[model samples]
Target chain A: MSAPARSTGVWTAAAGSAAAEPRETASAPPRRRSARRRRRWTGLAFAALPLAVYAVVVLAPLVQSIQYSFFKWDGVSAATWVGFDNYVTFVTDPILRSTFGHVLVLICFFALLPIVLGLFSAALLTRAKQPGMAVYRWIFFLPQVMTTVVIALVFKRIYAPDGPLNQALRAIGLDSLARTWLGDFTWALPALGLIGTWVTFGFCMVLFISGTSAIAPELYEAARMDGAGPFREFFAVTLPGLRGQLAVALTLTMTAALRTFDLVWITTHGGPGTSTLTPAVALYKAAFQNPQVGLAAAIGVVMAVLCLVVALVITRVSERD
Target chain B: MATTVAVVAGLALTMSACAPGGGGGSESSAQPSSISTDIASAGTVTLKMTDFWGSAEGKWIDQAIADFQKKYPNVTIDRTSEDWGQLNSTLNLQLQDDAGPDIASANNGWQSLGTLAKGGLVVNLDSYAKAYGWDSKVPTTIIRQNKFTTDLKTMGSGSWFATPMARTSLIGLYYNADKLKKLGIEPPKTLDELEVDAAKAKTAGEIPFQYGSLDGSTSALLGVQAVLADKNKLNDYVYDVPTVKASDVGMKEAVETVKKWADAGYFPKDFAGIDYQTAVANFVKGQGVFRWEYTGSLGLSTEQQKHFGYVQLPQSGGKTVGVGAAPGAMVISAKSKHPEVAAAFLDYLMSPAAGQTAVDLGLVPALSPDVKVPETSLSLTGESAAAKTLDSDDGYVPYFDWSSPTMLDTLGQNLQLVFAGKMDSGKFTAAVDADRDAFLAGQA
Candidate 1:
């Protein structure tokens, strides 16, 4: 509160001085701001603690992971430096290579589908001023609040051989089409991805809703007045206004997709023989499950680099006016 | 600004006090000479133990702990459980920081023990074992399973790193007895017979075989076992041979067998993504005639027990060889503060009472001349039957998954690719050969 008061006083004083400067130009005192400079540095140092802690806790370990990538250690033994062997192995290893492909597939479900469906839902919600809009928002966000373990278990049951999905298919006289949804190689990745889409789209929708609410309603009204239809209005007004929120959503969702381990571990443990194996799952198996810590660290570094590059690219694109 | 600095410094100190590693130096010095003795003297020693088994099974462990405390009123046991997924990641961090519980359950495998042993983080139990008579009773086979060479010293050979709480075979076929009866099919005794039974079940409007490969390794293990059985060469393939060659007659035969099974539509198309629990649920719901699962699956609740029958998996060509890793064993960590206490706990668990308790919970006791397990109990009966089969059959072989350190994932995944028709039989054999070669080279 004191800081705000001081800032307002400073602003008022600067304005007054600026107005009076021309009349008494030669008589203006030189502004020796050493004390103010000291204050600013002190304030900055106080502000830097959280960031410093974050860097130490998160960024330091991340950088160490990159360093560890070039070594071979089972976490308990002496580390052996092997140059780019780990990276080479990751790129060339058939299982890891296939796992990377699976991650790409998940990106479609976790990143692309969620954003598209979220935008669509957000658009519809914007036009509908209903009495139970809050309730709908809560319902959509329910999955987000529930633990991934619960979600995976519930979804596993829903996709079971005799579960509702197959039952429904049988009822519709589509017995031939009824197969174990999560168990089939062809359906496993897509089925898991669909769950990812369902769990995440609501978060994206909420982001869009908040972002759209901030945009002036007059712009949408003017677009309609100018003969722009709903679709055109969305593209011209809503989409552009949601660029920042879209960037955030995409970054978060994409990170979630790339780092996906929990739901897969809980539901299928990356099974039916590696059909659902992602980089994170592979990293875990290599590190903790198999004690190939060095290889796991290497995989982790690669993943971090990929995430960083993607994030930077998205941020640059989103920020481009 | 100076006041602000002072305030910040105060906050920093307060936060530092809350940090996890802050108390390490002082706590290390202040800890009691013996954790168990300290508990006894204090009239209540709260020892924390963490495990992967959830609340459902944890309740049994809790009951055991309660019984332990009742016998020794001074010792209070506080038990906590975490999911295996979280535990795997957290264990190393917790161990490194000395924040892990005094006692923890660990899988008696190289992957779990090797790193910790190498790091000199666990307690050595040789002295404790000798003193407690654990050296005599616990079988050499059980001891060998947990042994590891760490820093030129074998940390877990006769020494303990973790206690064997329960034993379960990794490979078995669980069937729905009611469904089998209705379909008028006996449990298959060979690969050909199994195929016929599966076909019959499918024709009778039931899923024949319920196996999930989504984890890739489970599918590969099943496929590998089937192939090994067919060749009547399961043991020779895994341990006796120095190197596995793709062109080797037995190896090629196994790969072909797996491919043939996959092509026959005996396995569900979506079997790859289903988890172990779901696979069991499918068996329970009569969705499948047989489920390839761990022997421990028989221990599932009454609801799960309703439709299932347990049988040893059919061998290739009726050779009747059993294969799987030796059951999980207990080892003592070298760094444990109370190695004697840990050893005592292990000895107690191996006693007739505790062994029976484990058997009652659907775990096989490691010691032979097993205590009389109640036939009515779901946990005891099936495992008892399997144990009886193993005793009678000379062809029982340990699981191939446990043969090589890295083969678990590699073989499992490759087998999946083969089953999915992504890899031909030749390529699948070649891949496994290469993997085995690489693993052997690394071991050397």
Candidate 2:
């Protein structure tokens, strides 16, 4: 096999040598052809590894999932072709309909809240000369590094009837406010959403901080020169510059919201009359807990399609301006 | 760069060559010579066992595995136990791909085993049971739960799918004995007496009963017991009937009885949201007169066991009944290479001595005659004595959550709705009927 650098050297040298040897054009053509061939083979070898990995890890499972959605299978049994029956069932299932609603609420928690909070924090940090700004950053970023299981468990204890949250409420003489956070149907979903917001805002804040740092100080200075206040300069310069990072953050956080399972499973397991059940949790219950793999696959397929569409829209909109 | 790529490629090839065939292959190949000479000669065997227990419970399993390893020095055990939240999907995914651990701790319910049996994923163990002398020792009812047909088409028809590891009788009603004494109630015997005592307890500013429909198991436990306490209804609904129709008069009566209890505030107001552990905690804290739980819950730590009384749930309308079941079972994987060695391991695990270990860990023994269970483990002391008497009277019935192949989740969820007052009695019954009908029809 030709060494990559050696082949590149041969090609560049041949081109340079051909330019000098104007009289031997016919001989130079054959030598150039061999160099081009070597380069082509080298390029193919480099691309093949990643392509194969992608096919195995991503594309293959995705295709199989789509195919499996059409079958009635309990994962182990003989799969019977049910056409679109599983999908139809998913569309009709009241629980799944409610789950989608929960997923939407989770989007607000995982995406909207984080983005808004991240922006506010970034704006504050960019101007403040606080002594413990670095400490604050570290504290805020702690949740991002903490395992979801630990977070879920800590939250579960806090949400329990006699937990510190309730104790604090009672300590302040707000007796009526001290109720089981995860028990009441009206409160459970919003409570779970609140945890999601808390766990994810750190990630968004970090992303925003990095994105804000990348914005040129010259642009901010120019905005200020144009008589722009901090907010105005932020809108004109900082926000526009961080558009790419925002797109990335929103996509990742939105996906996390849609596919939430650990926190819900650990905390509520879709309890309090299925009030906090998201699509991912419902799919897991259908597949493993209920052994309805066909239904689960159908849910997965639908979720994938929905996520793809939403992500596309979000990406397009984020890129537009 | 070319030299680097070539070196990496060489390393990759070497690694791939040593990658080991799948995962369980090498492990099964390395069984002890006493178990299998070929396995011993092949290399060290390492078997993986998965369970849904963490921390203290996980330590017990690890200790059991270590004990097994001491008896077979050549064989190594790889234990992978996680909490339920993690285990749920991991187990399912592994089992589906035929990449599951050689031994798995599985629930004994039909809903859990039915699909696996149908898929031919679990091994048939009739021959193993006979060779190991397990057939005569394990109770027929307990053994029956693990058996499947030769074709692995249905559970309880072929061979043992899992070995019974634990036994628990759903016999006890946890109550505050001090509170009951204060209310002048001597463990109510009849439904009428129970209601009167409950009212008295409530009047004395105590909760009559504390049960949470949150986890859904409580619904099945209380509902099945209600059906069992009425002999005529049990016969009509469970035995005499050819098919379970929702419109059956006995079922209707049972539903109504439960609803009545709910309406009278016999259960805690937030019962729909409290988990099993919380319900137990509340009972221990003197918040309620009675909380229904399995006999095994009595083995809770001393602090958790304070001042609790165990009594049988009172029979309604002159009949007494309760719910009980053999504990979870272990099944060999059909994909296992050394099925014989796996069978021997299960045999050793179910022996009287090994069975006693489980009993010592607060589970009842499946082999009743040979194993001696401790008095504290067996006794229904304090408030549990009356309940134990009622349970021992041959009126006790097995819980019906395992009655069918796929009704557990449906029943649990629907019951949650019922407890939450989101579904009326008629609607709940209809929903249950529809779910049962659908499941049965699918089986047919």
Candidate 3:
């Protein structure tokens, strides 16, 4: 191939070698230059549309919220300039800080637990390449495919006072342990967190499955010959090989944990005495329900910054490894 | 800063383009101030209306609208519906956008009617009240409950902005008739008797109170407030009179009652986790013997309605005296094209035909003293029970959370802590007092 590519374009055509590389410089210079310039201009024009749309739809709201954070507005009347008063309130307010604490707890359920569960699932599946594996994948992936609203509705019924959960507890002779899961301050937040875990574990599982599949079969075989067990092979081969996938999973799930709204909104609306009071729910209630748009915007800005920083830290750590 | 202004200005321009405003909202529509007492001659105007009426309320309002259209043949009516809790918030946004119904109903509050009035999105009905003699139409006690300042921050003394159609709501004890009869217990007439009844019901393995306080605990709090606070002091707090303090009517007993009820296993094992509808539905399904709910929420079918009996949340070891209530306020959009016609529509809702319709559907309608309401099934059950409280020398008190702008959140989020013994009464009261004081300070 290198010998053929050393020939000029006309000589290559005469040689009739199908593998001969064509030289772009062989084209007429003036026409090619003008056409290339035109293509570049047209490419920019097309890309310009989405970029503009991104700026308007995404960045514009962000900038507007940041601006709103610096004022006192009730979402209707004229905004009063307040400098950093709203942010100061957001950070200092005990209620708001507890909301952040709830978000951190959800991170364990939504990100940490899911990642660990996903790794176990991937390890089991890859070790054996079990029969009907696609079915297993689909079953694992079902939660991710279902809409959050529908999941919330289903879970609401499941967590009802007379729901199957308490009924099951009764059947198992654990009646003393049964209580309203979502309404109890201690249980409500964890119950909400467990739902986050249910929703995200499948997503992590699928990521790890794909990550483990791409591992070299020889690595496993070599590990087996060298006396490495299933768990050992996982750490030495499967886990290390999936660094990129782990980073991706951590980033997606952690960001989801940080900015959770719909689930919390639909489930408890940050209730049972602020036990489930997530920052996202706080922002929404502040803006819409409470009509404190400025404070809501300030909370929103802080949440966005927190998510970005955490995501960056995770990605940086994973890349280092 | 410039960018923010530009975006906001663009948004404002878009809103005004969508909905007509009465000269940027500060003034009412420039249309004729002349109005009529008679609905027949109200002109050939089609009125647009919006409210967060439930299906039952909507059904009766439809009856009212049909009767109205018959009286005013030339007028057409267009209506939009929204969720009860969401309507006011959405209306504020829609009004800001200059795009909503000619007349709207919002629950009276700093969040709802107050926002509308302060935003200059509604008509000041002072002229219409005199023109149509509505001053004589509605009783002052009921009418004053809906009044707000021109600034919309304070209530009790300002020009009236809206007319309340159905204002009489009382938090009453809803007991399962079958369960009570089988258990051979009469509806309790006093607070201690209620606990005795609850204890009996609990022994039958039934949840005594179908109380779920997830959203804000106001439902359960309503029952507790009825148990604790005096009617006059409750009114003073709700009306924002400066002399009253929450500490004066301490909720220590109220908190203890709730905690005791939970510990006694009188409530559902998972009561805190349940939502409003589930609790109500479970009660209706015979899973619970008693429920503490608003007067209007008892929209039981005639057959289903037979299985229930109503009594006020027993207060002060006497005949039930007070229940929480706030009049539902309906206001005309100042930007509406036919302000007179819309105002006339509001007037028609107060007519005999409409009042009868509201009565037939089992709601307490606010109307002239002479309009006779038939003693239907609802009247015998819910309305009669509510009357026992209201007609007692003391009238209904406003909801406890209605005391401040952030009081709902304060009660809603914190009350859960109190019930779960996560926070005691002192901490809960302190948090609530801080919110109320901050709101009052802001008002001043």
Which numbered prediction scores highest in TM-score against the true structure?
3
- The top-ranked prediction according to DockQ is 3
- lDDT, candidate 3, B1-444, per-residue tens: 999889867864543333222234465323355655665665678777887776767797788788778877988888887887777667876665555688888777676776677667888888777887777766554566677766566776678788866335667677887888888998777778888999988887777888767665566656766667776676666666767777665455666677788889987866677677767777788888888788767567766766787776546755455554433678888678777777777877766567567666666644423334443453235555465346444466666666676788788788788877788877877787788777777666
Candidate topping lDDT? 3
Pairs that clash in candidate 3? A180-B270, A183-B272, A183-B273, B19-B98, B216-B412
Cα lDDT tens digits for candidate 1, B1-444: 999889657744543333222121222112234333233444435566666765335655666776677766876656678886686556655555544566666654445654455555556454455555555655443454455543323322434544444344546667777788999998776566777898898788887877665555354345345435433244434442544354553556666665675677666666655655655666666677876666655356655554466666545444444443334344443335554455555556556666566665656543445567766654346555665455344344545554455667666667767776777767876766666667555545
Per-residue lDDT over A1-321 for candidate 3, one digit per residue giving the tens place of the 0 to 100 score: 011111122232322432457566755668578888898899999999898986776666766676677667666655666767888898898888888788789899999999999999888887776789999889889999999889988887788777888899999999888888887777888888898899999989999999888889999999999999888988999989988788777777777787787787888878877778887778877877776877888887787767667656765677683
> Tens digits of per-residue lDDT for model 2 on B1-444?
999889656744543343211232222112233333233443567776777766444555666677767776777767777666565445544664555687776665545655555555566665566666777665454465566554433444456667765334565556666777788878755556666887887788888887766556554345335534454343233221326465553445555666677778887876655666777667666788876666656455544444455555555444555554444567777666667656666666666566456545644443433455444522334323433333345454445555454455556666666665777768766775666566555655
List the candidates ranked by TM-score, beginning with the highest: 3, 2, 1
Query: Residue B435 deviation, candidate 3, in Å?
Result: 2.0
What is every candidate's C-alpha DockQ against the true complex, given to 2 decimals?
Answer: 0.28, 0.18, 0.30
Full-model lDDT, candidate 1: 0.64
Any idea what lDDT model 3 has?
0.72
Instruction: Decide which is better by DockQ, 1 or 2.
Output: 1
Q: Looking at model 1, give its docking quality level.
A: acceptable
Q: Which 10-residue span in candidate 2 chain B carries the lowest summed lDDT?
A: B20-29
Cα lDDT tens digits for candidate 2, A225-248: 899998898888888988877876
